[model samples]
Target: MFDIEYLILIFRDEFNYFMMKKVVKLLPLQHRNKDCVAIQFDFNDSIKAAVMKVGAKWSKTHTCFYILNETKLKQRLFLSLKKLNCFVDYSAMPKVDQVKKSVNKEASLPKSHAHALQVFEDYLIGQRKSPSTVHTYRNFLNLFLNYYAKRDLASIDLRSIEIFLEQVMAKRGYSVSSHRQCISALKHFSELNLGMKYDPANLYMPRKDKKLPVVLSSTEIVLILRSTKNLKHRAILGLLYSSGLRIGELLKLKLGDVDLERNTIYVKQSKGRKDRNCSLGQRIRPMLLNYAQTYQPKVFLFEGEEEGKPYNATSIRQFLKRSCQAAGIQKHVTPHTLRHSYATHLLENGVDVRYIQELLGHSRPETTMIYTHVTERKIDEITNPLDSAIQKFNRMDNETPNPLLSRNENK
Candidate 1:
């Protein structure tokens, strides 16, 4: 009997330890008046560290870590934790589809408003606007319609538009770019649907902010690339910086677009719907060759898990964030920041701005000229006036004796 009891105790302890290692609970909770998903697990230092790495915040009141209850974030959290062999139990939370339904119900427009938006979308399509542009314009028009749901679309005048813009700016805190897009969408919609003439004077367009692009130093770029352990991820970062490809352009790249022998990447239908050839770095060539052999992508250069499908932009961003963290870079880095760094570095290397403009597929030289402001080339070449003055003063002081010191010695 003593032997049997001892065996039972050992079994129970092992089971508890296994459960602690395997199970992670996710429950819906209201955190700071916002719906959040709380991550609850038994005390495990490794698990806690992993959750924190995934950007979950420890809530003191709730006594658990929580993240904003977003679908993408929830999926990311599940995948990230699952990689650690943890079984994420989110059974306590509502299904994603159910949540989306509730949100759609709350924001659904009336039939008349919906019809008007459909017409505006059709008009945008007829005008040959890009799918993304059409989607943005339609969404903005939908917002405008909902704001004036009871009023007729024909009744909206300049004052009404101005009022709506003011309310949106105050409530949603739209950025300068978003505000400008909103104005453009409204102007186009009114001209096409409401038979209003395009008059810039009547509509208020916010001035574009002249904020300089964030640039990573060459050393930081090297560190980011080196810190990325995955070959595919490193290749993505390499292509972005070496070839100066936009995230969208990079995604659209086919296998044939890359010329290893010529050391050029053909960017097709880039910004402004223009195709251009960009220089490829000799250093990245061998990595690409290795990645190609390993991945064996058929259609796109960098295919996702599913064959022929492009790798996700969000995945690139997520892994890039991890790489930056691993590299100990604190700057707010994004995929676009790599592009900016590419342009600035090239300018620093004495590349012509016009050539950069062509490579970047910028329709105007002025757009590419922005990098000139951020490049340190000219600034590094010019010495500071203060330094010059200090050097001159030091030379004079060393060359001549102090009169005050001589007088004091005589006294």
Candidate 2:
């Protein structure tokens, strides 16, 4: 039947007679049309059978078969054509064999949770928060909704909320920031959106644990720097350490931002949309110039494979992990560790804590003071208090002759 179908089509179009035995080209339609995959093919009997099996419909407007741009249909079509050995071009369609799980920090939720999240998102946006903040808020809301899926939203009492938070802390091991976000999401969503009162006295956010930022020792930092032979990687590590720029700030850096002449890197629109000049050491400037000569990054200082695309955060993390292994210093080193070490090392070198705060772009001096606990200044390396006190006591004893007339007797 397919042979007859092909022969009739061949007779109608003379060009079909000279066409290839089997070929399939997937083309994406533009100009405000994205509902179909325009699959153009010249087919043999087996290929025709496969197409018919997948219910490919010929569209006169498109001049090709319109396979609904859908996952199941695409999967079935690909599977049926697998045996034919026909050239299948999937350049137009992203592989949908597995639904790529969204990189949400929260657990995956069902569709019902999305409806609740939409309202929460609208409320956040209405508050004029940044888009990234709103997205993070929405994910936190999703986790809350997932946790209380069985309960009526309005009927959720304070006790249940407490239990849920405990589960997040104990079972999920969510960080303090995550826990805070969750509390904020629930409070706003319930009080503002659902018209339910969220009594903070009943369910209070946990106090943040007094944990020190993990910092690499100065020697370990040098080892990691020396181990990373790639010029781009070294510059990235060095710039991060020298300037104390956040990972996001580092990735967003433009070539024009690095001012080696003034020995400053202009950090633009950092965390709070605030700009500041971070000091770049004379040491890393030569390396930066060499890297510029080699890589020739057009726009962003740290570019990915394609031009103008910022190098991904994952790449930086991977580079740090690999560098740590090679340097034989493993303390769960992340890219942020480099920034932490930079701040702490600066503090250790007698740079004022206030100046370190400014360099780190920290909003609060208290936040910067956390590094002081970890840094061992020259003052800290002085003689022990016990030894100093003992020496002073012995010198006094040597000077004194008797309790009644000690001063003159010693002279």
Candidate 3:
């Protein structure tokens, strides 16, 4: 959550002082483990004339001073007082400033659990993790932090983290891979932001179930592209499939990023905020150039109706859904599917894993290697043991007399 104490620093007068009479002190302390206010002040007689006049009026209402209105006064008043320069001599008035300072210090100190999230985001932007990976990390952090608000990050034991993971998996119905991702994000955040080392030795990442990456056949991909005839829709899908661009990267593209002559498109601030150049297929270059001429987009490549701005990520997804429905493709295909198909096709065409890594803007070659496993080369070579056994049985049957013929002769 965004910090609230800063608001208090901006609005101090109406809350801490009554006319000329200043509240001598205010302290935040716990009563029955609940937040409660402790206040102190001087009477009118002890102050100067101006201060006295205001003090008399304030002194008349003793009950008002102590009983903070939970609805109207309690929290906002404290916030407001912080704003009005009332903390000028906070240290001189140790009774009030000391307590407030402690609170401020606590607020400034980054929460260990929360710091982990920021660190992971930094890595994502720097390392250029895939959009899906970044999104999953963000969702996991938000859910985890929202679950444990105002709790001391250092005090949270391993058991707490495990329990939270279990709740997400068992009660929240998260897959094992998702659970592991949540753990990975949190662990990175803690180590980078809070200086809390999460040793992989003691902590076991949940075994991720190995699943094959789904790839559409070349014919099916062509069919989907053909189904979407509109220039904008076609361009979006074309860029995704042809360049292996993520939907977010495609949506964030600026017009200048596309170099028509060189047949390269620059991806800026991608998954890890890393910029890279992706090849624009010569085939789509004319189509894109034509669309550019028709649209005349100002900044973003894919202009929307609102004065040529790029289409939002959500809108792009909506367009893809509409296009899929129009194409009558039975499989549930998204823009990312186009990217997956692109990578698989590259592998099938004998593009080296190292080269694919650079084209896909993957930080590690291992990540790009997953596409190799999804290619047709592996699937085509897969021979079933049962097929060999069946062939042998057929050969034996042909060499020997048929069982039916032998039985008929005996009869």
TM-score of each: 0.79, 0.67, 0.59
lDDT of each: 0.84, 0.76, 0.66
Question: In candidate 1, which residue ranges exceed 4 Å CA deviation?
Answer: 1-107, 193-200, 398-411
Write candidate 1's Cα lDDT for 1-411 as tens digits. 569889999999988877755689999886543578899988888788788766687777789999888877888888888888887888998887767764453257767777767788898999988888998877677777878888866666778888889897545666788788888888777766453334545887889999999999999999999999999999999999998889999999999999989999998877767889999999999999999999999999999889999998867887898899999999989999999999999899999999998888889899999998889997788899988887777678688855532245655
- Candidate 1: lDDT of 410? 50
Ten contiguous residues with the weakest lDDT in model 1: 401-410
Ranking by lDDT: 1, 2, 3
lDDT of 2: 0.76
- C-alpha-based local distance difference test score of model 1: 0.84
Task: For candidate 3, give the lDDT of residue 88.
Answer: 17
Can you give the lDDT of residue 202 in candidate 2?
A: 63
lDDT of 2 by residue, 1-411 (tens): 578889888776865533432567776542112356677776466776577557665565566676656677778888777667566777766444322332232335545565677777888889877788897777666767777776666677778778888886446656787788778777777756463445865668778888888989889989999999899999999888878888999999998988778899898888887899999898898999999999999999989988999997866876777789899995978888888999999988889999988888889999998887888785478799878886777777779843432244544
> Higher-TM-score candidate among 1 and 3?
1
Q: What TM-score does candidate 2 reach?
A: 0.67
TM-score of 1: 0.79
Q: Positional deviation of 212 in candidate 2, in angstroms?
A: 1.7
Cα error, residue 305 of model 1, in Å, equals 1.1
